[model samples]
Target: MQWRGRRQSSNIEDRRGSGGGFSGGRRGGGLRIPVKAGGGGIVTMLIVGAIAWFVFGINPLTLFGGDMGGQGSYQTSETGRAGGGVDSTPGETDNFVATVLADTETVWSTRFQEAGETYPEPTLVLFNDRVESACGIAGSATGPFYCPGDRKLYIDLTFFDQLESQLGAPGDFAQAYVVAHEVGHHIQNITGVLGKLNSARQSLPQDQANALSVRVELQADCYAGIWAHDTRAAGYVEPGDIDEALNAAFQIGDDTLQRRGQGTVVPDSFTHGTSAQRQEWFKRGYQSGNFGECDTLQGQL
Candidate 1:
């Protein structure tokens, strides 16, 4: 968490305070889709929508065409102030985000070089309210996501506050994990996992598709752990940093979120794994720091 005065990523695209500005609503906590009805058909549709979003890392707003369930709206918190968003000035929360991004770049670039491959750095788009990507339009309520269509990561920083306040996961490292996880999705995209997934999902049943999505998300969590492993090796991670990330992985588990939201657990609707599975995959990556170990699709999930 000692990120002050470090390298900040120049790939940031700031669109805050501009036109198409934030529509202003708090999305429901956790990664699960917000289904309005608990009926079997509604649950199945929600699962399909959520899995489709995960397949390409599409923003949920774009998945539902704006109101996701149309219930439990909250205000989006700003890092600096309400009217003014993050400034380019150093030592700010936005700069901290850039620093963490730079850290991932350093780690991944080195690893890719070791493997005789060049790392294609991804641009991170910082927007408020809504933003348009090659995939489609995304609202802040969709949370942070990486769109494979454009090879970019999009975030509304206010989701960080929601991660802390609503999801009960807070800390600098937790925020770093969020960014790293999205970048993990980008890694999958570059490595062709997403491409194969896209083609395969089309021929699979809804249940099988959801299961595959879980593997995809769990692999991303493992990749995040791999990044954390590199961070530790670089002497950047401090005590309690791993705990913050682990808690984050736990808080956003599909089962945990579903139980909290509707008092029931629909295993078929789980795109992301359970809390134990998430922590386990992350720990596996952190312990080995091996790309082979993070292969959730090929190996046991």
Candidate 2:
């Protein structure tokens, strides 16, 4: 991906060394619930927690406390770094993240404007170890997530290392796909799809809820592809970029991850779709580059 030298997003919150404490900023006050569990390790805990929170209508925060409170400091993307224990100079990875985020902002804003609507840009919080959001406290293990409660995206850059080393999805484009996927969730949140799914999941059984969650995740994958589509049109995508993203979607598919982790594939428990479904949806959006092609909820998958 040719992301360097491009605009960087100013809506980034750098809280890398803040010890996952609370920040008294725009959206504040969340309990610091450390994620500690045995057997499944950190990644497993994250996947299970994600399924519970996203598919089963269970709020991870509610399991520990009502609201979180603490004192911490952070730096915006434009400010480089803050006085906290964070590094004084932003690194290459940080620059890449901000650049990708800015691209997403540009693409989504243009799309929204074409539809006669204004896009509300989301803040991307970069943290280390753990972080607090309107949703709850999340450890680095929880991976990158978009909190609908606060309309912000949270990521620990270390997760990208895991994505390459453990998940077998390497390349800068794969990392961009991950960021775009989370941003896709932010799109869902602003469009009311996330709210509707949360409400609908409340009355559904686990299996049915998992099915809907799969659709939602696949839609996000397609949305990520939409971002990639725009990037390609702008001549930023290099050779093999789309393939890198596709590999990432395949590596993180529910079936692939389940088989790798548990030695079995349980379709009923899949919150995200299977490898083929994920790749297909992403391809659909990438090829069409139209928001109408991303109706994973009603259209054929």
Candidate 3:
């Protein structure tokens, strides 16, 4: 992905070194402990964290034990934000992300305008290690996510490293695909998919809820493909760009994660769909370039 030297998104927020931990207060070191759901439920939280870490791809450190001193208080380790501080490498990554985000904004804005609606550009918060969000306190292990509550997308650039080293999906376009996927979630949130998923989650069994999550995730993948379609048409994507993204799509699919973690496949436990499904839907979106084509829930799964 030839992303350098491109225009970045104005909605990007550089909170990479802002207040995260409590008491001492510093960047990338830890977070100011986030307010948990309730008092006296620490064990439940631990269990929740363990479950979520596996199911939702969340890291465990974001669960608890941050210093949480008042905001704007503290020191920085010599490393400086777990290596994010003053690092130009991530800055380059952010530049690429910004360009892709800008592209998404353009495409979605046009799409929305065609529908007689206004597209509100969402902010992208790039961080390292740990961060706090309206959805809850989150760490880098949570990967990239879109929070509908605050209408923002949170991502740890280090996930790019994981995508290369851990997930074996390496490339700038692959990283952009990740960003597009989250923005896809943001699109879903605005389009009422989140409410439907929430209602399903509330009423369904665990397995069924996981199934719905798979649909939601696959739809986002498709939406990302739709974004890619526009970017490609605009001459931003190269010949092998789609393949790089598909490799990424395969690497992080729920089926891949499940097989890696649990040694077997459980269809009911799949939250992000199978690798084939992800690749297929992404291809569908890229081919159709239609938002209406991303309905993962309409047909047989």
TM-score-best of 1 and 2: 2
Q: lDDT tens string, model 1, 201-283?
A: 76789899778878988999999999999988888776777888898888888777777667789999877788899999999
The per-model lDDT (C-alpha) reads: 0.69, 0.71, 0.65
Q: Which stretches of candidate 1 lie over 4 Å from their true place?
A: 18-91, 299-301
Worst 10 residues of 1 by lDDT: 71-80
| Model 3 lDDT per residue over 1-301, tens place | 5455666678876566544212211224334333233233564344223323332222112112232221110011123221121223424555567778988999899999999999989988776556776656665545676666677787766566656655667666777787788888788878877766665566668888777777877898899999999998887776567888798778767667667655777777666778899899999999999888988989423
Off by over 4 Å in 3: 18-90, 299-301
lDDT of 1 at 291: 89
Please write out the lDDT profile of model 2 over residues 1-301, one tens digit for every residue.
7765788888877776534322322333333445443345675555443432232122323222333232111011232221111121447677778888999999999999999999999998887766777766666656777777787787767667666656677777888888898888888878888777776776789899779878888899999999999999999887777888898888888787777777888889877788899899999999999898999899322
Pick the lDDT winner: 2
Q: How many backbone clashes does candidate 1 have?
A: 2
Model 1 lDDT, residue 208, Cα:
90
The 10-residue segment with the lowest total lDDT in model 2: 70-79
> Which regions in candidate 2 have their CA more than 4 angstroms from the true location?
18-90, 299-301
